[model samples]
Target: MAERSIIIIGAGMAGLSAGCYARMNGYKTRIFELHNLPGGLCTSWKRKGYTIDGCIHWLTGSSWGTLYRVYEELGAVQGRQMVDHEVFVRVESDGKTFIVYNDIDRLEQHMKELAPGDAGVIGEFCNALRVLAGREMPSDKPIELMGLVDKLRATKALSVLKAMHKYGRVSIQQFAARFTDPFMREVFPEAMANMPDLSISGLMMALAYGHGRNAGYPVGGSLEFSKAIERRYLGLGGEIRYKARVERVLVENNSAVGVRLADGTEHRADVVVSAADGRTTIFDMLGGRYVDDSIRRYYDKWPVYEGFLQVSLGVAHDFSAEPQSLAFRLDDPVQVGDQSRHWMQMRHFCYDPTMAPEGKSVVIATYAFTNPEYWNKLYADQEKYRAEKQALADAVIDRLDKRFPGFREKVEVVDVATPVTFERYTGNWKGSYMGWMATPATEGTWMKRTLPGLANFYMAGQWVFMGGGVPGAILSGRHAMQVICKKDGKKFRTSTP
Candidate 1:
């Protein structure tokens, strides 16, 4: 019999993972990517001898013996060096900073020292995470939406419901309200104030803090991480084609048979997995034929997470006094018009100086929540848009100048990337960096991988799954591959050979 063919759309982390897994499991696989390189938004760009990572803050499961082990089992970054951040992270605001320590005890102590009466709240948070650490999650495998209830029942029974009750029902905003300390409130406001409506469950919150136990970064940045996985995929005889935009998942008689590329290239496949932008995959490329009215409406109404305008700077001096990455905020608490005023996020390459030339450092200032219309108008008036971008970069530099006195003098190169740039690169609608927000209505109370009435078609990455960060995308890819592997009656190998 001929070998089963699997065609994966997009070469993002999710697509790469799905392709890697399918190839390892005896399925012939090919990946199509619009961009010349993979990794999508998790990619990095080089500007004037500085490497600027796009969306890397802190990745969970970088430490061994954590839920992230799934990545290692698949040989995602087996030999690569992972940097475990000693201090989890810190938010510097209004001359008062809150440090989240790697050690829970030390973090609790810091919280108590900062706010004495709020010890109970901090203690409860720790206890909740402790309980979650003990609970065993169901297999990472993806299955039919109809089979979720049965699978959960068989795996954890009432425990799953109990877990949801404890961590899934409440939003981060509701939980942050429990604190009486103003500084603690400002320090850890749960959801970013701008994202108040974004659905963040209690379990996810715990996992966020739980990451402090093992905060980390990949040595060569996000792109290197993607390259490592791609290397593994190709090592297993998997094929990847760049500039191949998939037009449709070829379906015959309610089963996916193959795909047709934009260049009129046709490739047959037994299964098709899409790791591209959810909106594009669901509505545009597939023509929304697989999704139901309810699902389609959810997509139309779902607000995508805010986009960003970033300034990648190569500084002549070092800003490595601090151990971990820092979040620098504005003096005035209220929101301001300039994207920089909304959130002045500064992440430096002090930990890894190799990102820049010797004696210099790479600093990225991201101003998130910018309107997409601003970029659209830029194309009409190039000079005016260029001036605006320079002004925004200057303002961010001014803000950093206050934080790091005379910081502007060292700036050798400043490259600005707006939402339009992200849209052009990743094909995300409105240049949304986080895909669609994983709200209750959109992601569903129970996460569903495959859309209704879709034969041999599946959705992965931030759109359909739990909408987690890097780990979520990788898991989504693996799960989509699992669906194919099971249908083929092959033994599902969890680890790479």
Candidate 2:
């Protein structure tokens, strides 16, 4: 039988993962990417001899388990050094610091010492983390492929499910409100201010994963990790066309047949897989004719993760003794968009030597949940956009100088990427790096890959998967391939590097 042909949109983690699996299953595949380079949102760029990493603070499956196996197969983790941090985050308020240690016992003791009045809630929180530490993510196989025995084995996740049930409905804000200590209340919410409505279950699971060493930072950062997957796909005889932006998915009698490029070029394929932005794929590329009411409701009502403005500085000062991640309350509020931000979070790359010069470090401060519309409108006026970026960078530096004393003098390079920058580069909706915001209402929602009344076409990436991240995006691609293989009456197969 002749091999089927597939065209995958966006050469990010999902697209690359789909290509790898397609090739392994005897399918001829080609990927189309808008950017000249791969990795979409999972990317980095060099500025003044310093590499500013834009993504991947801690990969959930960096070390072990089924997700790790997937990474190993995709060559994302082959021979890569993974760094596990002892302190996940440091929260500071009024000159008092509270550390979130990777060790559950240590974290419990620290929290007790900081807020002895709220020791009960702290103990409960730490106990939940302990329970999740022993659990592992299930295999990557789709639900249709799971047998009776596999279904029975899934019972092992009962403890995790119970834990999630108890805390999944409570938001981080609500969790913080339970604390009696003034400092604890301020620190708890600030620690997770970026994800204010994020469920406590999500919080515990992240801490648990970090404590268990499953979540670790891959050395060399996002671009290198993506390059590994790109190499794997290329090695499997898959073809990729860079700077090829798809304008539309050609449909015949409600079945997808191919795609038309932006420059009036056309290519036909037996299958079309889109790992691009969800809104673009449905409303723009497919013309929004194939979606049902549920899909419409999701697109209309579901909250997308807010975009962020990242200010990266190449500092000559060494921050080897500082925590990798730190969040603190600002004495004076800084103007960001229309709001005044009283808290600031900065991530130090001192642990990774490859990011900076021998004695220097790359320090990044991200202002999350910034309104994309504000940046989008500001970008229309080129001079104003550039001016605002510079002003914001200056304000951030001035504030940092107060905290670090002489930080302004040590800064050799400053790079600022706004929400508009992400939209221009990766084509993400509203410049949202992560797709849907994982709130109490949308925590475990599983979006269907195949749209209603649409055939020979599928969707993958962060958009389809709630709580979008590297692991979920990669797994969504694998699942898309599995669904395609089932439709084609072929067994899905994967190969390791």
- lDDT by residue for model 2 over 1-497, one digit each (tens)? 98899999999999999999999999999999999988998988899889999999989988988999999989999889999999888988887998988899999999999999999999889998988896965657766677888777877987887787778888998898999998888788665545778888877878898998989998998999999999999999999999999999999998999999999999999999999999999999999998898899888988887667899999998988878899878998777866788888999888888899898999999887789999999999999988988888898899899888999999999999988888899899888988887778875666888989989999999998777888989998899999999888887788887
Total backbone collisions for each predicted model: 0, 0
How big is the RMSD of model 2? 1.1
lDDT of residue 26 for candidate 1: 83
- lDDT tens string, model 1, 193-243? 335445445334434435444436777788887887888788889999998
**Cα shift from native, residue 349, model 1 (Å):** 2.2
lDDT of 1 at 263: 92
Quality of model 1 by C-alpha lDDT = 0.70
lDDT, model 2, position 127:
90
Q: How does each model score on TM-score?
A: 0.88, 0.98
Best by lDDT: 2
Candidate 1 ranges beyond 4 A from true positions: 65-67, 133-136, 143-165, 190-194, 198-212, 332-343, 438-444, 494-497
Please name the candidate that would achieve the greatest TM-score relative to the true structure.
2
